[model samples]
Target: MLRACAAAFIVAAGAGAALAQSQPPITMAINQSPWLNSFVAMVDEYEKETGNKVELDVTPFGGLLEKIRNSVRGAQGAYDIVNVNSLWLSEIYSGGFLAPLGDVQAGYGLPEGVLTYGDTTNWDAEAGTFAGGGALMGVPVNGNVQVLYYNTDIYAKLGLQPPKTWDELLANAQAIQNEGEAYGFVPRAARDSIVYNFTPYLFSHDAAFFRIAGSGKADVVVNSPEALKALETYVKLATESGPPGPGNIAQGELIQLLATGKGAQAIAVIAAWGQLEDPNASRVVGKIDAALLPAGPAGTVASSAGHWVAGIPRNVPPEKQKAALAFLDWFAAKERQVDYVRAGGVPVRGDITGADLGDDAAFRFIGAYSQNAQHAVMGLPFAQAAEASDAMALSLNRAVIGEMTPAQALNQAAADLAGVLERNGFAVTKLPDL
Candidate 1:
């Protein structure tokens, strides 16, 4: 494994060089994320190497979409590059906001590891199917995936090994709870948290939200028996072993709980690992370790990927566009990628899974994280993905708070999801009865 950007270095070689020399500062619309500091460090390195100034229009995660949308919709888009998440990538692509990655670049072919990202990196614009069948879109700067994190000190003190199955995880949680030394677990349940936090549970149970049937059809499997079981395990893990008033816990709170040494175990994104090692914000520094998510009743270890992609807007000026694309090439180079990881960024290169973590033993998490990400499933890839997620998010929150039984909540969510697909012009037929 190597630490570096592996995107195909494309052609036109030196065609864009002269134009990029005098290009305006490349503007990028990106969100504030756990890996942002590392990203910025890479950006700084790019500037120092290429003399290309970059303006990062950083905003909250939720606000990023609107900002990118406002820019991409205009005649001449505001930003040169837009950072998109797998969850809503279809929205940007389907709207024709992004130009194909090869349109304005001069780089080598994509690295084998980069192609492992599949639809997150490529798509079929004509067929409207996301199978990496069409042109490449962008590089996956963040190879984010869900993994179980445990406090090594706590696990050793209690003589507990990292759980390999959901049942074992719950048992460990209960054991930690009985000890009263720290909270057994922490779950993010507030406002859109359940979808991301609980996806590994759903996937481990062999459940999926939707299965694309064809270019214009899909089957909704969100309320299946497997999903119900997954949901049950999710709620049980949170309420029985998690901290008090678990319903209000969100991403920040979950990280805070673990970083402050108040939590023993939980599942979180690989990108979030940076916070655990930050000396100023984390008391659990050097005590935390990560592993693949435990297997579910179906004996599957699965997780959700929320990798972030970088794309150039079609409407941006040629010089700015070239500069932005070149920045991507510079940022992804092997040397730069190693530096990126060393600065606290997750590597998107599958080849890097074997890289030595230097003196930091904590970087062992990268192996687990990268291995898990290679097989991780995405949240959704349809243009109406946000609406679909909202439909389920409501039900998930209700179900988590015990306002509705798992059956009732998922049933309602499935029904609403069907309507969303139908309205979005997808012929949705299959429905699961809970």
Candidate 2:
């Protein structure tokens, strides 16, 4: 009897070990953003339902990139999943640092729209494939776009409607400046924030960093006349209509200026405006409204589409990779996407627009911005894109300080940008036809 009892105990221990092995937890690393908190909550709900554990290693957004790069290079598999900006997907996917998600999506029985491969308009086709890399690397976490946020009170006080064209924007700026008590406009012109604000102008004029060659490579086209014109126009606005020393104005100060009613208008990301609507977070509660960026010479308003993407790392085992993909599939379901939107996260799914949320004015504006984002450009390959931003910031600074002509500043920037492209292994090509 004693021998039989001991044998039964050993068998039970073996069974417990096997069960544990079958349900190992999946680990993920995410940048600290509001969306991440929602993801955590979702993960908890999923774990309760499925008995699958999730471990998250959260880090500041600034440090997350380096950590991901180093881990991928070292094959350390520190994270099974990571969130990255859509712009970096090309580099990471082409370099084989990310696992192919197509098969994983299929194996998990993910629903349509939950696993988007190409552009939303042409998902089955390869329209959004990154430079013909031939694989869908990641799933978009959020859909973001740039918009013009104005002080409605200021506009009413000055008898001005939102500008429809660049010229009109300039004229309105002048009108605001003539008031003398309030600054005309405030945009990010400093190194850290200028890129986000300046890219929209580049788009509004239909200029891009590179022109796509038929052979899936990109040729540099940053020095085009349209680009120069856009840069020159930006210089004029920063110097003539914006706050004094516009280039020296940091992002925090810019936001504060707008929130405290010191500034008339700002070109900002839609998400930033949502943050300002939060009662605990904003000083400006009912004073703001969003509109499309002014039209440029191209006769249309173009904006930059910024998206955050999530994907499984290649270093993980196939089984674990499959599990991570499963979690992502669930996280991107339309219901969950609505939850993300309610939490101030942008929605990538077409079915959930800001207008569907309710009668809130902010949500309605955000919906309009989302529609514009669908037509915006993507896939620019700026080597050290961050540094290129700094160069633009410097040119604006010079113009604001009255130290250089707009033409001179832009010309110098063109030359510097050519060097940046060449260093990144791109051939210096002719500027785009403006």
Candidate 3:
């Protein structure tokens, strides 16, 4: 039986070797995330099957863009595959750094429902295609959405219900803090992550940084009434109930605070929810549950998608490109995605929802994530997306650190984005009256 199993595995791997031969080793650049552990585990198997070397260059999230810029500008071909956040798609695609996957996708013909993991609430086919649906540019590998994580024990002890609205959320936080339970909540406030942390509130209140005009201009609207309401609400929550020195907090620190039971609740990315139930990493094992973000007064519940998409770089040699594309298809297949989920990686394949897991902590956490996907709002798409986002992040940080009032911060941010739009050749008319 053992020999038969080994023979079958080798047979299954034959296709990998058939894809290419005598090609230079392939390289992939991706951000440092917990799921990298699973990817590392699969490398040996991939090597055996493909008879080719594969190297991964994992870097901190902040350093990813600089690496891409340097490599692509130099035409160094240092990486064959590049992992990109959904937010980075527009900027990277506009630079022509990625090779369109039209031929490769047609040959592979990846089945439908396989790629439908994250929010498609605002997904546009043209954004993922070239020349208005000519070619595929990227493939989704992981999904992220915002969820409210709460300490079940604390809520039960205080006879409190999970908050369902903004007012209820704030009131619960104040009540929890008043009773000396834990820090009422924790939120990522560092400039690098603050925009994602705050956007859910902005979307919930129907506010936006800018809207794309029909003529392809960005109409700055960050200083509108709806934006002010969202900003003030986010600031008030962080100021009144969040931990001291929140301006320094990032995603890792927020997870640490929650896992150690120092925080009673948080609105955070669903990808990190597994940490609270990890026996080796958490003091709050079996005591945490997740739910959708609280709604705004207008009954809007919104979230932001943080999905990562992979694409081949234009610099790779033709033979090496074929190998890289084959590996990409194999790695993102449904079987591997299921294995990834079992290893605590975030699932992006639609078929591997929480229902596949037994009734346990993992199931409970992912259930919230699956439901929240329906409300995700992919941000505005444009070449200056990252620049505008950076400006907004700084404004959020300023408000959090008490350097500026929410209105002052937002007004300045709006002016800064307007300048960015104008410099990018997007004629900015009068600010929209939102």
Candidate 4:
């Protein structure tokens, strides 16, 4: 009887050891969107490969930010991973709520070039480093570029080719409006959409919200003549052919109008085209195509590139930190990046350009856009960027709705931006030469 009891105890101990080898379940929080679904699918594949279970917590964008801020402040570390925009890096890093990933990147054999973009040793190092150089804070998950999406059918009907410059775009807009079948162009003129859709124009004109005269210093430049010109053009386009209250339209409504063939073109994120192509979600599946945004007086076109950034929160257990890095290394691998592209997550790897994918029209369009992304511009850095962006958006909406002249709106926006920077303790300086 004693021998039999000992045998049972030994077996139970072995079972417990096996269970311990399995990864503890982890939960990730995300803003509710179609992208979240794609991420969940990738996590499911990761779970199967590593014997780990991951739970996803979906919340509205606004709510997600508040919850994350609260969780980090309380040192709760409720989430194992979080998705952050580049602009929020400063605020979050300043709070010492994120763990550095430099060692983790080294462990994973991440290439020098990949790290360079996010490395402090390179240009804009101050922007990439957190809290005065503690650790690498985040891994870029996906690439998003703003592009000009058009309905192929609509273009064919009007005998229109892609606009190569701002003048051409204006001409096309007028022609499309004259046809009286659909609006010529649509952009997010209202809410935050205007800021997101319009910044590329500013950059294309060699204008910036803040000009970096030195390595780590940037001066506000929103009131420059070039910026004023860009703003005026944006307002002109919306007033001439866009729908009523273009400044008030939601992104969803704007997209819906474009997808239903009520609009001819939109300056939109490339990922949005995927949403437009999903037969289950879009009615314009076969008719849409995209290209880079048109050039301006600066003789260059600009697109905005945004990526999903993953980072470890500070105060996580060391072992868990190791695990998180392991996961990120595996997730950011080139093979996995390709898989992510196949699975509808945009690829950020340099080697995995859109052209390298299959030769379908969708891939062709995405590839062209991705190739041009190397020159795309990023918005103002995260510190107080959101507030500044909101002010810009508000001013843009006023212009779009004819509530203010372009000059009046832009001047006010520049003043408002200056106030935001000042309130945040950043010094205000002259606008850039442009």
Give RMSD to native, each candidate. 5.2, 8.8, 5.3, 8.1
Candidate number with greatest TM-score: 1
Model 4's TM-score against the true structure: 0.82
Ordered from best to worst lDDT, the candidate numbers read 1, 3, 4, 2
List runs of model 2 lying over 4 Å from the truth.
1-24, 106-134, 212-218, 360-362, 391-393, 431-434
- lDDT score of residue 318 within candidate 2: 78
lDDT per residue for candidate 3 within 24-48, as digits (tens), equals: 6788888888777656555445666
Task: Evaluate residue 35 in candidate 3 and report its C-alpha lDDT on the 0 to 100 scale.
Answer: 73
Worst 10 residues of 2 by lDDT: 1-10
Evaluate residue 158 in candidate 4 and report its C-alpha lDDT on the 0 to 100 scale: 88
lDDT of 2 by residue, 1-434 (tens): 00001010001122212223344578877777766655565565556545677787778888888878877766568777887775565556545677767755553333454423234211212322353234566677666667787888888888999888888888888899999857888867875666566777877788765564533345555557787788777877777888877877777888778877788887776667766676776667788888878888968677766667777888878788877776666666666666556655677765666545766565656555654565555525432555555655666456556677655665566666666656766566545333
Each candidate's TM vs. the true structure? 0.86, 0.81, 0.81, 0.82
Predictions in order: lDDT? 0.78, 0.65, 0.73, 0.67
Query: Per-residue CA lDDT of candidate 4, range 1-434, in tens?
Result: 00001010001122212323456665565667656555556665666556665666778877877767776666568776776655565567666677767653453334322422233211224543222243557666666677788888878998999888887888888889899888898867877678877887788888877765544445777778888888877887888978887888767877888878798888877667787887877778878887767888968777765555677776566656666666665666665665666666676665666545666655656554564465566566545667888877787788888888877777777778778877876666755332
Candidates 1 and 3 compared: the better one by lDDT is 1
The residue-level lDDT of candidate 2 at 200 comes to: 71
What are the per-residue Cα lDDT tens digits for candidate 1 across 1-434?
11222222222323223334545677788888777777877766555545668878888998988888999999989888899888878888888888887777644345555533545677777656566567777877877888889999999999999898989999999999999988998888875677777778887898888888877888888889998998899889888999977778988888999999999998887867878888998998889999878888867877787788888888988777777877776666556566677777788776665454575676878777876776687656678877788778888888878898888888988898889989989889756578
Clashes of 1: 14
Q: Which scores better on lDDT, 2 or 4?
A: 4
Backbone-clash count (model 3): 0
Stretches of candidate 1 exceeding 4 Å from the true structure: 1-25, 32-34, 51-55, 59-63, 105-109, 115-118, 126-129, 297-299, 317-322, 353-355
Q: List the lowest-lDDT window of 10 residues for candidate 4.
A: 1-10
Q: What is the Å distance of residue 102 in model 1 from its true position? A: 3.6
Off by over 4 Å in 3: 1-25, 43-54, 57-64, 70-76, 107-110, 114-135, 297-299, 378-380, 401-404, 430-434
